[model samples]
Target: MPCDFLPAQRALLDATEHLIYTGGIHATGVDAIVRKSGIARKTLYRHYPTKEALVEAALRRRDDRWMAWFIAATSGYTDPRARLLSCFDALREWFASDGFHGCAFLNAAGEIGPATHPIRAVSRLHKRRLFEYVCTLTRETGLAQPDEIAEEFLVLIDGAISLALVFGDTHGADAAARSAQRLLRHIPVSS
Candidate 1:
């Protein structure tokens, strides 16, 4: 069923995200977005002056959705260490889901080559925010170098996602989570 409750701009962004994820960003044009969104060309143009703008908006929406899902998935664990490992559990679920087309940020980065591209910037921001969240979890474990450990954890997370995408298997998350558990072993949990 169509989500008529969403605002027109949000509806457009959601449609664009679906199209861009299923189809390549370059392959999904404004006309396609219009047809998918069921919105008029004038309205789409008025809301987003250019395709790049629409792509950025779609990415931002994706970033919000992804983060919220991640946080919620990881929130059930009471232990800080378990919470940290839950990141991978979340990835496993996401990978096995219906629309598992790899990381949207990575896809956008590839599609928009320039480092300075607005979509690339959104992708980078999403990654940095994820790193920050990991850092928060690391700090809770009383790790001496939360920043450095968080950086390493981020690499594991991204690597797992990439591998899962490449090999068409969710075991990457398990491998990454195992590595994460080893890394957390030395650190003392805060009382």
Candidate 2:
């Protein structure tokens, strides 16, 4: 039997992720990915069965890549404050990248309207983890009200993303990072 896992299959998924994230899920059709990946239509269908499944796989891959980056970002800083700043640093880097298209989770969430949508679930989980990570960092910083700080931080990040997308500038992300750095610096180091 042929190997269940194939490099071509991975290439298709990777290509789908790039197209979907850079563009929008709805905007980039299955044919677009198949063409971009140079994979036969049959091969893609054989692996994914449907476009939605392929989209979900692409979304999952993006999430995994992002989570890996998050983990690595926190690893270099021992101080929770520095670690928290790293969050904004990462966001800034992401926003500043050449193909910078806003957040993948945000885009996918916009595409998949229903709460029950697989893409929605993936997007929700990604945002939840970011929020929870901030909360954990806030708690670690021993802030008097970590929960409140985490909430405020999340708002800042989300707002920054929106403004960035609206204005087609990375300034919003820069401002958010500055604000996060200023705000997080004040949290007491305890927990």
Model 2 worst lDDT window (10 residues):
1-10
Clash pairs of candidate 1? none
Q: TM-score per candidate, in order?
A: 0.92, 0.86
Return model 2's CA RMSD, one decimal.
3.4
Alpha-carbon RMSD of each model: 3.0, 3.4
For candidate 1, the per-residue lDDT at 165 reads 87
lDDT of 1: 0.87
Query: Which digits, one per residue and each the tens of the lDDT, describe model 2 over residues 153-177?
Result: 8888888878877777778878988
Residue 19 deviation, candidate 2, in Å?
Answer: 1.1
TM-score quality measure for candidate 1? 0.92
Question: Clashes per prediction?
Answer: 0, 0
Best by TM-score: 1
Off by over 4 Å in 1: 1-6, 187-191
Instruction: Write down the worst ten-residue block by lDDT for model 1.
Output: 1-10
